[model samples]
Target: MAVPHYAYLKMKLLGPKGLIIVVGDYCKSLECAQAGAKLAESLVIAEEQRQLDRIVALANETPAVPALAKEPAGEASFQPSKETKKVKLKPEDPSCSKYVIVGTRLDNK
Candidate 1:
């Protein structure tokens, strides 16, 4: 059997226990870039926020180090790395003359 033209591609969040995120067209023949953004935001921000909230609640009840610092993963482990960050690419502004949508085959053609 042939593979479908459109499918969700899994993108992994690299970490100790990684997250599997799916990105693909939400609707048939839709702009994939637009769908990718929506799916990424929902998975990255929304799901991550909920997990953080749950962890914060648990930490409050436990007596440990300063609240500002993150708890160690294990007793033998060293302090966690502080390089957690997100790199966002600036979007193309439609108002500027530099933007153009190319290579899309119009149905009418």
Candidate 2:
């Protein structure tokens, strides 16, 4: 069995002949730990970039607008639930053209 002492940066074990010891340099350990942390951060950023790319690929996707039910007065009527707001794309955002923004956090229905 091997026992490690992190504070002393040493590992001790019983060898076939006698007691064996391993030592670690503090500076080297610090450098290696920093490199490991950077690698982990890069991996997370790469994953996020892949997800962003997938979402961006659907830039041309258009949401289906369900036909609103007509009232007895022959007028299309749609009153969103009190918790939801039905908003048409505003002229201020020309890029959003025919898009509708639902105020509620609902799945794309």
TM-score, per-candidate, Cα-based: 0.31, 0.53
- Give the Cα RMSD of candidate 1: 29.7
Q: After aligning candidate 1 to the native by TM-score, how far in Å is the CA of 15 from where it should be?
A: 46
Residues 31-50 of candidate 2 have per-residue lDDT tens digits of 99999999999999999999
Top candidate (TM-score): 2
lDDT of 1 by residue, 1-109 (tens): 2233334543445445765454554554367777888999989998899999999999898877756876678878775445443323335644544443333333425
- Alpha-carbon RMSD, each predicted model: 29.7, 15.1
Best by lDDT: 2
